[model samples]
Target chain A: MALNTGNKIPLYQQIKQNLKQRVKMGVYNEGSSLPSLRVLSKEFGVSPGLVQQAIYGLESEGLLAVQHGKGVRVLEKKSSESVAISFGFIQPYVEYMTFEGQIIHYAEKVFDRRNNFMIPKSSEGMASREREIVEHFVQNGVKGIILWPIDNDPNGEFFQNMSHRIPVVLVDRMVDGADLPSVVLDTHEAGCDVARHILGKLNCRRLLVLMDNLVISTNRDLIQGLSEQASEMGRMMDLTVMHLPITDFIQRLNVGDYSQVNMYIELVERQIREGGYDCIFCPQEEFLESVIIEPDMDKKFPELKLASMTGPMLTRSRKYNEFGVIRWVWDFPQMISSAADILQQWVLRRKRPTENVSIQIKQWQSTE
Target chain B: MALNTGNKIPLYQQIKQNLKQRVKMGVYNEGSSLPSLRVLSKEFGVSPGLVQQAIYGLESEGLLAVQHGKGVRVLEKKSSESVAISFGFIQPYVEYMTFEGQIIHYAEKVFDRRNNFMIPKSSEGMASREREIVEHFVQNGVKGIILWPIDNDPNGEFFQNMSHRIPVVLVDRMVDGADLPSVVLDTHEAGCDVARHILGKLNCRRLLVLMDNLVISTNRDLIQGLSEQASEMGRMMDLTVMHLPITDFIQRLNVGDYSQVNMYIELVERQIREGGYDCIFCPQEEFLESVIIEPDMDKKFPELKLASMTGPMLTRSRKYNEFGVIRWVWDFPQMISSAADILQQWVLRRKRPTENVSIQIKQWQSTE
Candidate 1:
């Protein structure tokens, strides 16, 4: 097809459209090489510069791959049919690397076969890095984005601007004041569920809750849920909460330091031995691994029914019930899938939910 | 192609395979009518029953559509290419309907375009319904399943059996000793986050944490986090947890019964007027909506900073910050995506993580 020089459309765009149609009609099949730029220019009576520009446009769209010596090859036929809708999934560092990997993997597995996903090569929870990732995805024309935003992100304007252009679904965290769709867990209900299990089902009256130094929103929800449940069972329940400073321990552990680990372990042992508590609740698994799993801690505190709000590392040498620990499981797949679904709908159908999605929590107990 | 009746392969299956190949090779274009059963039987020199069976098999696989008086029509030329790998997503109920719907939608969006998803028509957290849904998906050959399991599920054996056959990713809740993969949130940390926000950020010296009667794991974790943060701050923090008997209010709210909502509201008003507290923490949104949003509550408690561990219904008439309220947003999408990813891996590659995935929480303050 010859270019319409008098048309309002740019010359390069006109050439690009013609070649795109030819590719769609199977004149240029996938993996097949395209005609030389000189031949195309001569045939269309257009400058070689226009032909080069058109080819470059198609190359960026992932329809063509340019090889210096082998010539430009059609990477996909029926370009429109073969062009998968792309999505960007951005997170702050891979804290849960396997879990994050699985989310991307499963999202692709369950997503439409013609859709594609892109994630950052490395993320450090830095505002600059986050901005870079977001801008890159936007420039690449990703249909939508699923972000695990940085806590108290400073790049609110960037996110707000991006949201206006395309659907942005915040995953794990959200930036304050940014009007974006989000999918969050119902940790309040999770706390209530755990409290019910402990007070109603397990019939524990006097309980001691052990906590660490890290302050987070989930931690607050759990406390509220527990307090509410305890108050509901008032007089029948006696609860005491003990907070330990573990920021040092955590930082040291991260650097292969274990000196303070024993100090915290001994302190926990003392609390269990001295307090007349029917149940002991540890909010993190570090306490279980560092203190409870000691040689005969289970025997020493056989009467002390143990519960945690974290998952048990099943692969660890210590097994649940062996040390009498019960834990809760978070529904990550549901959260990821839901975010993807919402983002897709927002991108394809321009539909957004009236409220944020909240995933539920599950309880797990070891069977001996 | 003639049927090989003498061979081990059934005549119907052989014919079905031959027809399938032709469809894939574009011999029978999409939407074209196929020969009648009698005509096929005569042409293949086989019994009509075998020909009918072959056609029926193809029909079930979505290759052909049969109509009364009309012949079997090719629905898809590349039938197998379009068939999606389906997974079952079963939940007791969509109490969190928006959230649940988003999870399913995002899962599908990120899931392989060719893979499909199925859900129960109606579920009531009943063991029978759960059993039926699981069995149906299994019978239909779903690659895997993502379930919001019922507590103390009666169909333990069934789940165990299915786990042996295909991958099962448990969401929301889990049965005791099921040995299934799960994803859960860290409510303990959520609780800590709130405590730090109140005592450290807001500089609240005297805090009254109002809790309801529901005893759940998240509740316990929240209380633990609060107490831990409080203890770490030592003399700088004075915390009092008041448990209110609001089970009736909660039940009514669940079923659209708001009569007792006033009584709970009045109680909260009285507590604020006389309790001599600097801050009030509510674990759920219902309490904040019913009590704190009253016409003059904000004016009456001008010094009190309100916080909750749930998302604020932003579209509601009541505005946050205007009513001195801040809520935490849980990252549900991250949880769902993570779960979908893990489940997909387990189903497609037989890979399971050593532990469950936990999505974090974020805080949102009302801009108004």
Candidate 2:
């Protein structure tokens, strides 16, 4: 844990709180238009998105009336002047897509704060929105923001090129080329763990790894880590890697009805039967359903098994009864807290934490 | 189709038509912070989310620089800008947890937009961050947004409140209080269609309708529609409704992998053994998988047949060669376009669209 610099908090948050305190003291009347996201972001020298995230947080909390373009107007005085805290993701909760469930679980467990905290919907591939949604909290006067940047760029040009100007803790993804604090699972180790599990426990000869074509940094690292581990296991273990182009497949699924059998499903099943891949690894929850739901797949591909690299348990909804495919649960809270520590350092203008944050993907072995 | 008010045409489009316009202008002038989302939203009187969505679209196009806590800054001069548009949802794209193969097929089709029109990844539950992600596009200067608001609001307060600020259209869910444009299939008719097909075509008598819980408004509509149509078929039809609590099931599975085999997988197998329901109507993809994937489902539940409401073509997948699930493809584009129309009226300060935009959910009977 690091000290909270007064300015380390997001600009919008700083402004909103400043205004909120004034309101508590009767400095500004209620029903008044607050400073715009731009004005506040500029005053605090932070991205407008953080400001927007802060404001939206306040709006959701009923402290702000966002009359569309009319600007954010203070609705009612805070019963107390303490600013609320919030966090957000650019992507939807993991449950909706592949890995994680609703984001609220991870949020509740991590922040564990007394003030109102929020988890924003994850945006699909809209990197810029990732920044803005966080700012929404700042504008409405949130105390801090916890964000999950895209995994690919641990410290990329975006956050590095610009100053965060707020207390932001990065979770899940790393910001490449920058020292801003972040926390993420050791995907490389997770991949290594899965590979070791398959080669060691499963006693499988030919293993095939199937995944989406795009090398999302997280998945890529997992692949690399797995490949490395498999190699280290020596000639006794022979493995082949197949990168299936599932991007189009995912897109089609998004547009089409949720009620029919499609080609990709057929292909994976075919792979399991014809390709003779001993074990299948699916990174997302969506894929898990397909494997387990197939009627007696154990009979169809008796040699094949399933595994997954998943987010925290909080992301998984109550409906996931059978954990047939997922061999492990990558607890997101531990890593998220670590990432928050790094972000807090950046906000406080402290020298970046020297500790190298790494993750180990754990696996639950098949008892059978 | 309706006049392309905020289509994907970029601001620099004229440069393609006239090359002379390029070099003569410095355009954005380096380091100039682009107008913040609030400024743009206020200028256009659109919701900040719409603005942010547009801004993200533009940022993706390299038209803007989004700095954290600062307003959007112009990275380089732009020849043209993408206009902003607002959109809504009409139909739900549901998926079964076990049907991975079908998901791939659908993903491919929807995302094949010639590398344009990015749909943000969504988690299961609607996170609070949805608004800010949309606001990013507006700030970046995207031309429009097509959104599927969360389906949980039965009263449609989400769309009703947001429609006032932008050009929004409704998708799968429709509301009476808001005159939002919509594209939808008559779920009731679809249910009726299923009833007719199962009883009239398949000649099945006893039926069990396995539906997801009523968190989604469509779940309620679907149940109501199916009940009405089943009743119309008279005494020949014996209908028993069973709601599958998916949330509970997913959690158990996430915590322990064996929950699937011990709980859901076994329960499904047992249901087949009792053989009370000759036909099953699974309203979502998840339910469809649960009914069909048990190890001995085909053997024990020879009389059991299923009509799946949503999809990922689990049957078409290799796991089940005789996938008896009925398929339905939704008209997502039309639904999105209609929602855009409603949002447009709001953005332009015109009269709200008429409230009678009722959509009949469409169903495509599977030949397989």
The candidates' DockQ values read 0.01, 0.09
Best by lDDT: 1
What tier of docking accuracy does candidate 1 attain?
A: incorrect
lDDT of 2 by residue, B284-307 (tens): 544345435534476666666776
- Among all windows of ten consecutive residues in candidate 1 chain B, which has the lowest summed lDDT? B312-321
- lDDT (tens digit, per residue) of candidate 1 on B237-264: 4787888765445445444345675676
Winner by TM-score: 2
Worst 10 residues of 1 chain A by lDDT: A312-321
lDDT of 2 by residue, A1-368 (tens): 22223323344545455444445544456877877777766655567886777678777767777889689887887543443333333433332343332343344334323222333344445666555454443432333455566646433555553334345555666566755555668888887887888887777766777777776677788888888988888823466666765544543333333444455566667776676677777666445554344334566666667666554442232233343565576766667656554543343332344555775666645454
- Per-model TM-score, in order, reads 0.40, 0.51
At residue B249, candidate 1 shows an lDDT of: 56
Q: Write the per-residue lDDT of candidate 1 for residues A160-216, one digit (tens) a residue.
A: 876766678887665777778788777778777777888788887677887674565
